[model samples]
Target: MPNPIRDVAPTVADAVANERERQESTLGMIASENHVSEAVLAAQGTALTNKYAEGYPGARYYGGCEFVDEVERLAVERATDLWGADHVNVQPHSGTQANMGVYFAALEPGETILSLDLTHGGHLSHGHHVNFSGQLYDVTQYEVDPETGYIDYDELAALAHDVEPELIVSGSSAYPREFDWERVGEIADEVGAHQLADIAHITGLVAAGVHSSPVDHATFVTGSTHKTIRAGRGGIIMCDAEYADDVDSAVFPGSQGGPLMHNVAGKAVGFTEATTPAFEAYAEQSVANATVLADVLRDRGLSLVSGGTDKHLVLVDLRDSHPDLTGDDAEAALAAVDIVVNKNTVPGETRSPFVTSGIRIGTPALTTRGFGADELETVAHHIADVLDDPDDEDVRNRVREDVQRLCETHPIYD
Candidate 1:
């Protein structure tokens, strides 16, 4: 069948086809990325992007925004219901923007903020010196224990008390263990600091009840619509009703201008999808696949940070298993074999960020595509093999072929 859309809209069709091929050919192991549904993609490509809805529902800076207002309203409602948030702001363009809104709402410029260090599995927005969060605010970073590969809760409390930061951020890009939200909330309470949990990676798990939700404990929560949620690209911020206006204003007049209505519509759809029974099962399987992969890696004598994961991603410390292999080498070698994964910095990494000694792998996308524990075990072994021999072109070609067959057996869109 010759598709009319592909014939007429050549560029758009080519891009989508390329993406489909990319997904089919390679094993997607990135913890922070996912395959959104075609419906979500359709919404994101709609005419809704042309509308200029600068303000919230019933309060707009432009007319002809009634439909967009409804879309944004539906998105807000779904987000609140999914995460049990009191107030929702669905305007932020990215997770970083969502975090920025929280920062602008709760803390002033130059105020001290305590967060995890980037080198220790924390996100850049948490407090890297070059990021706006650190450049604008006095950021004091805390790190996980070098020996335990976990957060030192007592040390975090001591540092909070000593420095008296106005805000305490709890989140990570690579940390593998379940966060202690109760302890974070208590510490924030004691320090009179606002606590924000950036659960961008874990939102779907929390929503599906596979992991704990921090919305009830933290002053605010922010997450990306993608990742484990299988949503389209965008960010969301949630908090209590009292801080709603401040957060909204911070996102709009304080930082950005007009909101993307198409993205808002996609968010609405994604939120609805996340609340279903099928999504819950997918979330559960995602965690299960991660556990199986971790076990396979351990059986093969690979050292995973924190021993194993309680979430979708596993942090592999390659120092003991592949002593000569840097993270960059591992990522390249795996990518050559169609096993796509990103290099990450484990806690107390002895190497630099660009060439660190760890790799972050996850199972959400594959689990969504119907790969189970056995499939993941096979993937783990293939990954180990690829890393064990980076220079073998024939091995890479064989792994690529295997990935295509596996992906065909469990196609994403089907």
Candidate 2:
């Protein structure tokens, strides 16, 4: 069947087709991205997008919400089962919004927030000066130990005691290791602070049991559905039943108006897919691929933050191996060869955020494309060669051909 949008709007259709082709042709190594199944794609494009479910299931302000209420209920139930949460809210627009929901529900304005520093493998929403969380709260930051490239729990505890924050956030955007959730929870309890664990980047791994979950250790848990989980694009909040009403209200009447029911349906489908044994195997392989890639890079003389990864990504700090090469330059060089990655700030970054000292490479998208250890090893070598001489046209051309071949070998959608 012909696409109705293509028949009506050729320009928009052309852009959509080009975007799909782009994804099919490139190696997506960005740490926070993954390709969802065609079922998820279709669900997000369904007629449910036209409906506005302004409230929770059976409590919506809008009429004709029977079907959408069922969709939202399934999303909530499947997510709760997948993550083992007491309550799940699948209404937030994005992971940032999900964090906002927690903040809005838990604290008043000008309260203190203790989180990891942005340049030290933390997220902007955690407490960056430009974000709303920063504007509304007194934000104090903790950093990784400079020598070990890992969070310094002693310093974090000390800072929490000194700051006496209302909330302590535990999560990262570029850190390449697992967090000690129980320890963090203990520190929060000692400091009399609420713990908000943002698992946005590793939602799928946590769901598949490849990574430890923070559901029991945290007062609230939030994640992005579309990362490793391969859900539709949106965020989800999980909390205990006691906080359920506050969280739901914060998500709906506080931050957003109506829920995107189509995306909720996609979440329901993706959460169900995550419960399968095949997905468990896939999550395991993704971490294995990342480990192989990390070893290959380290063997090639690249310095990895934390020395390696316990998850699906590895952060390459270019300051040691290539002092003159900025992360932006490395990102551009990889992009030239059709291997896409994002420039990121390392634990002890000395450069600006836009021109950082590191590049983050992930295995989730490539693994979703059916890549395993051997393929990831080859890709890692290609990446090393390009970073070794980013200005070399011959090297770029050779890697470009190999990347094309790899993409063709592990094609994504039909």
Candidate 3:
């Protein structure tokens, strides 16, 4: 394999080398991250990146887009078919931009948008203060049930009715349970609000029919290509065909300048691959592995948010299990032993987001590498052991050896 270096600067080459080393050496357990296929990587590095197709297919502002147009058109068609979408916009550079396009197309500036609170699992683009979504729009926040650690639909509906928001954003970054989109849709309709499902993490599950589809109920749906989709980095927006022109214009001129045709082609490839029976089996296994992992952790006396999981991710509340170990400390300790995960705020986090009370782990990437319930159980055991003795070097060393052995059997993209 050729390195993404030599022709690049030494600093850039060193960064690439470090990234490759990190991926090769460590276990990637981060819920929002994954390893892309070689085919997708190759497509990303193709010559299409050299061209700037400023507009949509067949209506470009610039010429010499014949091949690029075909790639983008194929991406649009495949994405629409993949998600059963009436219309698809393959132009958004990331999930954040996809969301931006939706807002730009549907809502006026400073209109009220009801979204889950950031510390409680909502994304930054969903209306965190630092983000443009918060600065440009009037945001109303919602929270998970203090007892259940899940979005209480009854409470959410009452909030929606009270705020009468112009848009209601649904999705989560750390939530473990399945969403009730139908009820959410009903609440949105009652308030005359637009419902947008930011299913960035569960797009693969939805694609394989393993999770609930939001396209049927939501006015717009958005997702990242890299996460569960096992594709390259990009974003897609799905909506009804009647809004196709509005979405297309919003993406092309309102949000991003030029579409990445190479990424679009890779997305097309991913969409095609996601249609296979193997992909369905893989998606199903992803959920099963997560369920098994969650059970193992809970059995070890670790408190899990939402009690358990219905998808690939689990949120482990470390405060009750290890009172002294902050989420940041636990995350660093685990990384030293080759187990990777992110620190996340739980339902009622006592600490700030920077030093959260919980850690988020997911099995989709590992499951994609052929790991099943047995391996995940063992992995969970080692993780628990590491947490139980975070200061013991010998214990960490032993866990490191176990992790290496486990990862060897299920080499990603081998």
Comparing 1 with 2 on lDDT, the higher-scoring candidate is: 2
lDDT tens digits, residues 1-414, model 3?
Answer: 665565667789888878876776678899988887788888888999899999988999999999998888888777777899999998888999999999898888889999999878889999998999999999999998878888999999999999899999998878898889888899999999989999999999999999999999999999998889877888999998888888888998998899888888889888778888998998999999999999999999999988999999999999889999989998999999999999998877889889998999998888878888888998899889989989999999899998888777777656
lDDT: worst 10-residue window of model 3: 1-10
| TM-scores, one per candidate | 0.96, 0.99, 0.97
Q: Which stretches of candidate 1 lie over 4 Å from their true place?
A: 1-16
* TM-score, predicted candidate 3 vs. hidden true structure: 0.97
Which lDDT tens digits does candidate 1 get at residues 1-414? 787679899899889789888987677889898888888988898999899999889999999999999899899888888999999999999899999999999998999999999878889888788789989999998998888888999999999999999999998889899999999999999999989999989989998999998988899999988888877888999998899999999998998999999999999998899889999999999999999999988888899998899999999999989899999999988888788899988877889889999999999888878899889988999987788788988888888888888978988776
Please write out the lDDT profile of model 2 over residues 1-414, one tens digit for every residue.
Answer: 788888999899999999899999999999999999999998998999999889999999999999998888888888988999999999998999999999999989999999999988899999899999999999999999999999988889999999999999999898899999999999999999989999999999999999999999999999999998999789999998899999999998999999888899999999989989999999999999999999999999999998999999999999999999999999999999999999999987889999999999999999999999999999999999999999999999999999999999899997
Q: Which pairs of residues collide in candidate 2? A: none
Worst window of 10 by summed lDDT in candidate 1: 19-28
Off by over 4 Å in 2: none
Better of 1 and 3 by TM-score: 3
Model 3 RMSD in Å is 1.3
The per-candidate count of clashes, in order, stands at 0, 0, 0
Ranking by lDDT: 2, 1, 3
